[model samples]
Target chain A: MIGQGVLNMNTISDKVMFYRGALVPMAATFAYSILVMIYVIIRSSLTIYGSMPKGERSLILWLNGFSVAYSVMIFSLIMAMVSSLVGAVTALILKKVLLHFNPQFQWNKVLIISFTTALALLTIHYLLLRIFLNGYMTFDYPETFLFWWGFPAVIFLGVVVVGSYQFNKALLGQHLKGNSTSN
Target chain B: MKHIKRFVSYTLFFYATTALIYWIFIRPLHLSWGATFKEINKAMPADSLISPNRVVTTRAINIQAPRERAWPWIAQTGQNKGGFNSYHWLENLFGASMVNADSIVRQWQHPVPGDTIYYGKHQGYQTISLVKPNECYSLGGWSFYLHAIDSGNTRLIIRYPSMEVGQSRWTSIYYYGLFEPLHFIMESGMMMGIKHKAERQK
Candidate 1:
């Protein structure tokens, strides 16, 4: 009975740790996704305004602003689902690769490393965006600073995603080689 | 390699299809809802213009003061008095700064017809179009567009077509629907501010 109780406690602790590791990325993605949606909305509105006559521009501008807000809400819901699915699939694949490469390679350490790295990259991307946007939004016409501000974030995310994929593959390969020789 | 290629293709297909659907269906659906600018404009009278898109608000005041009396206050428009001047909320968002009230108020004590007022990185050249001494005044000025466009130079023209009379239904409706507390702040609140100042002088 005591052993069963201990096992239950272990499961609970693992869940708690998993949740803790996941929380920051979830929040970051949600916030960044909203920002991206807002940017898209504003950009769309500006386009509408640009196309309209001078007298009618403001009407379209306001319309675009409200539309963007609505889009952001929808995006947040979709982003949450995508993030969880992607995160879980990634973690599972990494675990499998580690097991195949070296039977004794630590899984927990790799997860912690990946989670922390992703979190750091997200933070840096947001900071760089804030710097480039200056003080105005895309809704403010002729204020194209926001585009420059946010473009770097996309580049950074691309780099991180590709680099992590390569690094994970290399780590799994080394682990597999080390374990096969030992056995 | 085949699996990797498949994954890439699938991701690209999903994203492209989703984007295409959004552009074709969702965008048009939103535009059709009268929630769009074109639709809203069709709803409005031909002469009316709504500045901010989503919200509606506006205000106006009638004063028994001539154009000369009102010109000073209009030229030095600020937040406390209901002008975009000193609207700190807008400073960060739109790069607008309200003129110094002290200088504006002092300089505006008795503005005649043609006076130039200065604010940060911008200028206001005031002109009195019509004036009935101590009765009514129309105040207008050359104000550059808030956007950084070099389209000659834009202007803000406020016409006070009444002395203690309400605005036309058309003006009221557009202002109420589009401008909001800002329209109220500028037309009514600022007008009241001008009236108080001008009346005090009288």
Candidate 2:
């Protein structure tokens, strides 16, 4: 799920901020992917090259490691780009839907809107998988729907709502301190 | 140095959050498909494949093919028969020697309830427990149900209910953390393979 921070865009500057924030998640994903790729290479090397001579093994390991690292880097870049695009679109759709339902923007209403948005995104995801990826939906649709859709929605809303609240508080504190200093 | 620290912190937070969502929410959801509470809880013939104590994971796909067309591909799933329709190279790496059938073999089309479906060399196999021609079948702890959504469409549902006997705490952790995620990759591939094969049948 895209960060709820992305939902606060009101101006071109806010969109720029959203993109800037996106770098955090993208960099995290890239680093994590590289770490996993390295781990996999090491594990596979142990199993496949364990019996080989030390010198030959190290040479093969370095060669294979470099290739895997290269592939991982390329894959991570693609992943970052694709996910950012998806996140942007999801954020836009969510903002639009939230505005439609809760123009006043109560906290409770925001939570509800976030939940609804998440479900909408999940449904679209399921449909896409079915149509394009030949993905299966579970036989027990009700349980699957609740757990799959509900858990992420709750987590996302909690993170966003809380994060935004804390951010606002921090900003307010800074502004108040500035005023005091000026006075 | 401060910027690097912030970057590392941010990266860790992002990674942790994504991982939590995936393990707790996304993985189970994707693995199970859109099964209902009642459908998952209901007893299936495949239940006989294992002792009653187990975790049942069920997934369903709507295929643009009739049940008859889909049945043949599933009926012949084994090492020497029609392959599991997953990653052939990966299977071969694991000593499955899997050669996925491009065309359904006529001889392998008549699997019975007592027959065994070999997964790989060391990978434990599944025993056929139930067979309902063009409708349903159960092998080991997994059951496959083909329901006609319409004249031209079928809902292919696969249920895997495995017993938790002899599993240590570490094994359980490994099962959830690693085995399941890897299993999903192959199983999802198999689901797609079945869909493609059935749809291609004229």
Candidate 3:
């Protein structure tokens, strides 16, 4: 449910990076955020099988469910909004350095920007969890940080890069003719 | 325009058929989610209001906090009190105007049996059937049981016994098709909401 779809190719101005730069990428990031929420919720849920007593597991589940009352996808919305803010700043910096005044949407440049935005999001999540989640002992695995953070980071990179790439093509009136060589 | 119309009709038909099949085939799993056979068959306090031949669904979740810490939250649940611990947005979309509380208000504690549990002006209300501090709580047709697995951990199990109205086809369709899913979503969210408050704080 992207708000508006199929904009006129002429309406989108080149060198501005309006939809190509922000909106589509934000949409993909939003999807990425939903995936992260699902992952976090599921991971928290799976801890029921850990060595912890069933009561503690219930507590974790209760907390996880409460997040659900944050209502099904609202957790994602919160995560998306925060990640988007971080991503917008990262994009601005990346644009100044790599995407400056380029009307031509280089595939490589888009990939690089997506990767960095995902990286920034991943870094923030890692720092926040590291600082706050030490005492409660919710996550038991040693690789909890890398696994949890890494999964979402990988998803963010994949979604934003591919979604932006395709949408940018439409934004700029470029057509992919079956094969990559033709395009 | 014609192509779009055909697509819409096809999608609606497919969804309706699929939903019915799911209700018939996969409904039991959802009804007994995370519950053992023993738990489902076991009698709990909420069974006082349960009618025979009605569909009974039991869902259980684990909590990190002990019953003592979790009891206040379970006690204060009501429309104008702690709220249902469901999606406030969904409730408000139906004009329920629920603002769920994050903290247990000292004033709202101490609910007793026979109290009418308000679910706002927009919803049908359930009366409080049972309330035992740090033990169990049941409101009308649903029951919430708190079992301490250990001193530090608690297992919260909720049983909801409900069924479709037999009066009319429309009522049956509405009950099984729409109401059941919505109840599941809301109730499941409530379970999580309680768990979240208990574990997140202490």
Candidate 4:
């Protein structure tokens, strides 16, 4: 019974690892999408608040600027680190998904997909900044914020692309060896 | 070969389309937001704008002192007051020294319309479009920059365009409310120090 209990614990841990590998990209994508949505809403609200009465408007602008700046810090600095860790861990899980669908299908496609997805996110970030922040033409606040945050966002996207590829390659190379034999 | 070409074409077409759309819509809105923000900021009373525009407080100071006394104080700025002068430090950092680029003396010579000097910074040059010696000092074709209000008793105006990034809002607020007092202390203190030197020499 003690031996059986140890076996069960090992199996459970393996299963957990398997699922974690599969979930990384999806989770990162989900987080990126959610943060973008939040940014969109906040940017819009601040834009509207700027048009109100002078006293009220200034107050709103200050509050919104401070909030948005802080939020970007949380999203980029904190969330990116977490997501990168997730990407680093689950590199092989995507291969399983591909393998299950078609054994011959290459895991390279997952890397391509991740790259395209990261690229799309980056493009969208720029578009949003250009639309809401005015591409550095007018005020110093939004323009300055964009200048500072812009590079980090690019770095994050790059990580997403490269990290996803390495992770997928590593995962497929490792687990798929045994997993493939069984199939 | 045909399939690869088709894929490349599609990717390129999609990228172009999306980029164009983003440029058209997003860029404009961002500009609009900035313009709106500027309007709101400029709407504040001149004085209100002062505290916020500091590091180089452009808000004019109306001094009871004669122009000669004031000029000396202004010229002698950054002499022997702890370390370096506030204006000199500011000028060094932002390069918005009101003085001639060569001269340490930041004086507006009976500045009048058509006699504008460039007050440097990234905000673009401010033309001293108008200057009435000992009476007023205006800049840019529009009436902004330092304006001397009265002769013997002058109102020293420092017209700041807007705040830069990294300049905290709280700093801006603190500047307007407290700067004048600090300025009064520093300038007055410096003046007294200067006066002591002159009087002792006599």
State each model's CA lDDT, in order: 0.39, 0.61, 0.61, 0.39
Which order, best to worst by lDDT?
Answer: 3, 2, 1, 4
Per the 3 Å backbone cut-off, how many clashing residue pairs does candidate 2 have?
13
Question: Each candidate's TM vs. the true structure?
Answer: 0.28, 0.49, 0.52, 0.29
lDDT of 3 by residue, B115-165 (tens): 877786446788888888888888876889999999988888999877733
Fnat for the candidates in order = 0.01, 0.00, 0.00, 0.00
Model 4: CAPRI class: incorrect
What does candidate 2's lDDT look like per residue over B128-156, in tens digits? 87888898888766778888989999988
Taking the candidates in order, what DockQ does each have?
A: 0.04, 0.02, 0.02, 0.02
Candidate 1 per-residue C-alpha lDDT over A1-183 given as tens digits, one digit per residue, 9 for 90 to 100: 111111111222334333422332344455555566566555555444433346645543443454444444444445556554544444444334433443333445445555555556557646764688545333342233333334434533443344334444545555455556767
Tens digits of per-residue lDDT, candidate 1, B1-202, equal 2443454345445445544554554444333322234323332221133233323321222334444544455544433232433223323233343433533456444434543333222323345433333233333421211111123221122322211125578665444323332222223223333445543554
Off by over 4 Å in 2: A1-183, B1-15, B163-166
lDDT of 4: 0.39
DockQ of 4: 0.02
- Native-to-model Cα distance after best TM-score fit, residue B18 in candidate 4, in Å: 44
lDDT of 1 at A140: 40
In terms of lDDT, the best-performing candidate is: 3
Steric clashes per prediction: 13, 13, 15, 23
